[model samples]
Target: MNAFEINGLSKVYENGNRALNDVSLTVPKGSFYALLGPNGAGKSTMINILADTVRPSSGTVSLLGHDLFNERNWCKRRMGVVPQEIAFDPFFTPREVLRFTSGLFGCKPDEAWLDELLDRLELTVHAGKKARQLSGGMRRRLLVAQALVHRPELVILDEPTAGVDVELRRKLWDFMRELNDAGTTILLTTHYLDEAEELCDHVAIIDHGALLTAQPMRALMRDIASSYLWLNYGQAVTLTDADHDALAGLEPRSSDEGVCLKLGRSENGDSTFHQTYQAAVARFGPPLDAGVRSEDLEDVFLRLTRRAGGDDAAAECKS
Candidate 1:
C-alpha cells in the first residue's frame, strides 16, 4: 500500500494565486521520493497540505489509508515534517527543544533515541547549547531531529540541507538513507537537483503549479537524453551563421572565450557528438579546444523549465 497519496490536490491562496493545480502523486511505503521544481512551483504548498498546515482548495490526501483532512490526529502521529524554515525558541537547548516538541505530540521523552539522533546528526556535543548559540548548520540538524523525535512512519524534509555546509549536508543524506533503509518513507523537496539525483529513488518535477512528470529517477534522466559540449580555446573563435547551421541537431551558443554546443534528445553519446565537435575544433584550428560531457539532472531541469517558459515563481522555488 502507498504510504501517502494525493488525488486532484489543488490549493489556491486568498490572493487568487493558484499555488498547486490538481497535483496528484503517490509515494510507496519506504520509498525515497524527491519533489523538485523552481520556486512558486507549489512544492511547499503541496507539503503544507500534506502536513495539515494548510488546507487544499480541492481534492483529498490519504496517508497510510487514512484521510488526512479528517483524521488530523492520526495522520499527525504518523507523519513528521521538517519545514524549509528553521524555527525554534532561541533560548532552549537542542534536547530541551526536542523534549518539548515530543511532549506536544503526546510522546514521552525517549532519552536513548533522542541521544542517538543527536549523535547521528553530529549534534551530541551541542545538545546542551541554546538554539541561538548553535551555528546555522547545527540549527538545521536540530530541525531534522525535532521532526524525528516522535519516530513517525513518514518524514517530509523540505529543503533540509539548504544553507548547510558540505559535511553537514553529506551527513544528513547518510542519516536519511539509513532511515529509508529501516522502512521509513521519505519525501524530500529540494532545490539541489544534484542532491535529488544522488538520493531519490523516484522523482516528480513540477512547474507553474502543474505536474510535469513523475517516474523513477533513472527513467526520468533517460527520457531527457541530452548532453553538453564545452569548448575552450587559447584565443577567441568567431563562427558564421552557416557554421552554426552545419551542426544541425546541436544548439550552438557562444560563451566568453569559446562556443558551447547543446546536443538534442535524439543525439547519441559522446562518440558521434565528440567526432563532430572535434571536427569543428579542427576546422577552426589555432584557438579551439573541445570537450564533450554527458548532462546531469541540472541540465534536464533547466531544459524542462525552459520548455515551460520562464515562470519566475517556479524558478525562485528551484533555488
Candidate 2:
C-alpha cells in the first residue's frame, strides 16, 4: 500500500493565496521520498495538512490505509514530523521532551526505546540539559528523537539539517538511512538538492502549488538530454562575440583546472561541440584533457520548477 495517497488536494489561505492547486500524488511505502519545490510552492502546506496542523480547502488524503480526518487518530499515530523550525519547550530537558511528546501521541512510555533513541541520536550526553542550553545540532537531533519516540511508520523531515554542521549532517544522514532501510517511509523536503539526490529513492517536483513530475531518481536524470564536458586547459582562452554565439547555451565558464561547457547532442550535434573545442584550443593552446558527466537531479529540478511557474507535465513513477 502507498504510504500517502493525496488526491486533488487544494489549500487556499485566508488572503487567497492558493498554496496547493488540485495536487495529486502518492508516496510509495518503504521508500525515501523527496518532496521538492521552491519557497511558497505548497510543500510546507502539504506537510502541514498531513500533520493535521493546517486544514485543506478541498480534497482527500489517506495515510497507511487510513482516510485522513475520518481516522485521524490512526493516521496521526502512524506519522511523525520534524518541522523546519524548532518547536520544543525551552525549559524541558531532552528526556522530558520525548516523554511529553510520546504521551501526547497516546503511546505508552517505552524507556528502553527512548534510551536507544537518545544514544543513537547522540543526545545521551545532553539528555538532562535544558533544551535551550544544548547546541544547535544537538537541539536538532532532539527534535528528531522527539518525532520518533512514538515510533511512527512515516516520518516527514523539513530542512532537518538547515543549521547543522557537516559532521552532524553526515551522522543524521546515516541514522536516517538506517531507519529507511529498516522499512520506515521517509518524506524529506530541503533546499539541499545534493542531499536529496544522494539519499532519496523517489522525487516529486512541485511549483506554484502544482506537482510537475514524480518519478524514480534515475528516470528524472534520463529525461534530461544534457551533459557537461570539462576541458582541462594548460592556459587561458579568449572568446570573441562570434565564438560565444557558436557555443550559445553551453555558457562556458573557467575553472581552476580549465573551462567547463554544457553539452547536449540532441539539441545541437557533435559538430558544434568539436568546433567549440577547436576554438578553445586555437585560442588557448592544447587542453590537457576533457571529462564528461551526465546531468544531475539539481539540473532537472531547476528546469521543472522554473518552468512550472506557468506550465507542468506528468511523469510515471518507476517503483
Candidate 3:
C-alpha cells in the first residue's frame, strides 16, 4: 500500500490565490519521498493539508489507504508531522513534551523508547531543561523526538534540519535513516536540494501550484543528459583560432581549472563527452585533469520550472 495517495489536490486561499492546482501524486510505502518546490510553490499548502492544519479548496487525500477526511483521528494517530514553525510550551521540559505528545496520541509513554530517542537526538543532557532554555538546534531536536514519540507509521518532516548545525544535521539524518530502515515511510520537504538528492529515493517537483514531475530519483537523473566538462591544464591556456573553431558549437567558458564546456547529447547517439574531450585534447595538448559535472536536481528543477512558466505565459497570451 502507498503511504499517501493524493488526487487532484488543489488549494485556493480566500484571496483567490491558487496554492495547488490539479496535483496528483503517490508516495510508495516504506520509501523515502521528497516533495520539493520553490517558495510559494504550494509545497507548504499540500503538506499542511496532509497534516489537517489547512483545509484544501478541492481534491481528495488518502493516508496509508484510508480516506483522510473520513478517518481524521485514525490517520492523525498514524502520521507524525514536524512543521516548519517551532512552537512549544516554554515551561515544559523535553521529557514532559514527549510524554504529553504520547498521551495525545492515546499511547502510554514508552520510557525505554523515550530514553533511546533522547540519546540518539543528543537531547539527553537537556532532557530536564525547559523548552525556553534550549538553543534553536536543541529545540528542533525536541520537535523531532516529539514526532517520533509514539512511533508513527508515516513521518512528514518539513525543513527539519533548517537552522541546524552541520554536526547536528548529520546526527539527525542518521537517526532518520535508522527509522526509515525499520520500515517507516518518510515524506520530506526542504529547500536543500542536495539533501533531497542524497536521501530520497523518489522525488516530486511542483511549481506555480502544479505538479511538474514525480519519478524515481535515479530515473530523473538519468533522463537529464546534459553535462558540463571541466578541463585543467595545470595553468592558463590561451584559446587560439583553431581551438575556437573546434569548440564553436560547445559553450566554452574560462574556468579556474582551465575551461568549461557545456555539452548536450546529440541525436546521432554519440557520446558528447568523448567528442568534447577529443576536441579539447586535440588543441590543448592533453589537460592535467578533467571532470564532468552532470546535471543534478538543481539543474532539473530550474529548467523545468522556467520552461513551465514560459509555457504558461505563452498560453495566457494566446488565450
Highest-lDDT candidate:
3
Q: Is candidate 1 or candidate 3 better by lDDT?
A: 3
Local distance difference test, per candidate? 0.82, 0.82, 0.86
- In the range 98-151, model 1's lDDT, one tens digit per residue, is 999999888999999999999999999999898999988789889899999999
Per-model TM against the reference: 0.85, 0.83, 0.87
Per-residue C-alpha lDDT of model 2 across residues 1-319, encoded as one tens digit per residue: 9999999999989998999999999999999999999898989999999889999999999998889879998888888999988877999999999998999899888999999999888889898999999988788888899889898899999889988888878888998999999999999999999999999999998999999998888777766535666677654445567766766776665555666666555453342567556666665567788666555676678667674332111111001
Candidate 1 has its poorest 10 consecutive residues by lDDT at: 310-319
Give RMSD to native, each candidate: 4.5, 6.1, 6.2
Looking at candidate 2, the ten consecutive residues that score lowest on lDDT are 310-319
Error of 1 at 156 (Å): 0.7
Lowest lDDT block of 10, candidate 3: 310-319
> What pairs collide in candidate 2?
none
For model 2, the superposed segments whose C-alpha errors exceed 4 Å read 232-286, 307-319
Q: Across residues 26-122, which tens digit of lDDT does each residue of candidate 3 receive?
A: 9999999999998989999999999999988888999988999989999999999999999899999999999999999999999999999999999
